[model samples]
Target: IENSGDLIRAINLNGGSTMEWLVDRGGGQQIITVTPRFDQDAGRWLVGILTEMVGAHTERRSNPPWVALRDSFVNTWELLVLVKQGMSGAFSQGSAPQLSGPIGIAQIAGEFTREGGLAGWLTITILLSINLAILNILPIPMLDGGRLVFVMLEWVRRGKRVPPEREGLVHLIGFAVLIGLIVVISANDVLRLIDGRSFLGG
Candidate 1:
């Protein structure tokens, strides 16, 4: 294929069918047969080849403040959409969810800071902040979304409120569950670091 996008599209279109290809190398023609495999990361089928633009430029360009802000919003919206799609497919058939905990976050931050310097650090910081905001707003107890849910429920009940003891109990249980999840995720992170394998076989 000419480019990576075209290659991916071609493979996806081909689905599970075997493909035959003609290759030109060193003034000789060769035939190759291959089958596409499903890739969880891209959520698509691939033939395990890397392709790039014919004449891609690596130089960075500066944009005006307004244009930069607009692009930032656009990128954030795209990320949100991607996250929504991932969440929807997280539990789908033959799909496994991958998560990073505090240790993983630290490793990622350190790697970015060392390899990409200031730009990478700032980018990761912003992403983490946005992730925290998203998590806080999820409809789970002991979070802002949980409080909002209670408010919504009270409004629907004509100002009637849930008992203080019950609300406290629910929040406590939620907090415990949250802590347990963090611990489990952290342990998984440690295991991945030790073995270089994903928790759910990638």
Candidate 2:
């Protein structure tokens, strides 16, 4: 590539590149080996004037486990907050949060894989786990949080407990609502994808 930015993006300059150069004289064409010159100034470097081959290989080191876990937590927490805001109409004036179901999760997982490979998969997995953990603890019927609600009520009553049948019915209805919500969100995800919309601004 003639442009340094292109070269850097194609591969790290510190790693250098093995390029084939074509030199043409009236007699014929000849191929030559060319090496890129490194510059201290950012984006101020050249690889070749006319290049036949422009490529390089790189070895990426994944972040340490602790760092990865920490980052995953931060990212998941941010995502949860964004979801909450979107659900609460916080972004009704700007970018809306992209709520996804199974299909959306799978699509996003594929994207993460394309962008970052195994690390992406691991990161998304951890984030999903975090989402599940937080969501399950929310004081909503059919969730662990819902059960906790009854337990708290029992404590407040000193010794009395809510009837098991009533609790079960409440959770049963909640389960149905959760399932219906999932179906609706999944349909939305499919529609958004069909319309070629941006998930970030959905």
Candidate 3:
């Protein structure tokens, strides 16, 4: 009964490809034949459904106090999972970790403002802190990980150090590229802000 809505169809499977469902949702129990749909781009069979269930009584107005801590921990863990997938190139076709600059940041902040204003800002801040900490651990030049790489190299060579000038040059080049990427992403963000559409190539 909780799953009833505007009468979205339901599916029943018995550990095989065969399927059945109930379409009429007026508290009737008549079952009907349902079929999964296939799409070309996504290349998957979708059993179209809205699975969310709401309470029979009035919904709770606010969360319990303990929910705050639980939510924070759960959200942080979810971010960690995404970060791991991102590092593994799960989100990218070309193996580059996608970067968004200040403009994207501002748009996301604006979204949070709509959700709960001050509370949303606090959540964004915590999320950003965790993301930055994870990014800082990557072995990219001009970052903490880059500096650690140099130290490791020296250790491998038993104190024979590479010239500071060469290492400095590499860092300078990497920093310039990073700045260029930020500029491009920021420009995209500004365009998105102006037109209210993203550069996500929709």
lDDT of each: 0.76, 0.68, 0.64
- Among all candidates shown, the one with the greatest TM-score: 1
lDDT of 2 at 93: 33
The TM-score measured for candidate 2 stands at 0.57
Root-mean-square deviation of Cα positions for candidate 1 versus the true structure, in angstroms: 6.4
- TM-score for candidate 1, please give it: 0.73
Candidate 1, residue 73: Cα displacement in angstroms equals 1.1
| Poorest stretch of ten by lDDT in candidate 1 | 84-93
**lDDT tens digits by residue: candidate 1, 110-137:** 7777767998799789888888888899
Give the alpha carbon lDDT tens digit for every residue of 1-202 in model 2: 5544345444332224466756677889999776644333322224545444447455456899999899867766666654453343324334333468998888777777777789888978877787788789999999999999999999999979999999999999999999999999999989978997645332
In candidate 2, what residue range of length 10 has the lowest lDDT sum? 37-46
- RMSD score of candidate 3 (Å): 7.8
Which candidate, 2 or 3, would have the higher TM-score against the true structure?
3
Cα lDDT tens digits, model 3, 1-202, are 3445323222211111456654557876878665644322322234565466555554435778899789778767866865554444323333345456887877776677666579878877877789888778678889888888999999999999889999999899979988888899898778777887643323
Candidate 2 at residue 47, lDDT?
57
Quick one: how many clashes does candidate 1 have? 0
Q: What C-alpha lDDT, on a 0 to 100 scale, does residue 188 get in candidate 1?
A: 81
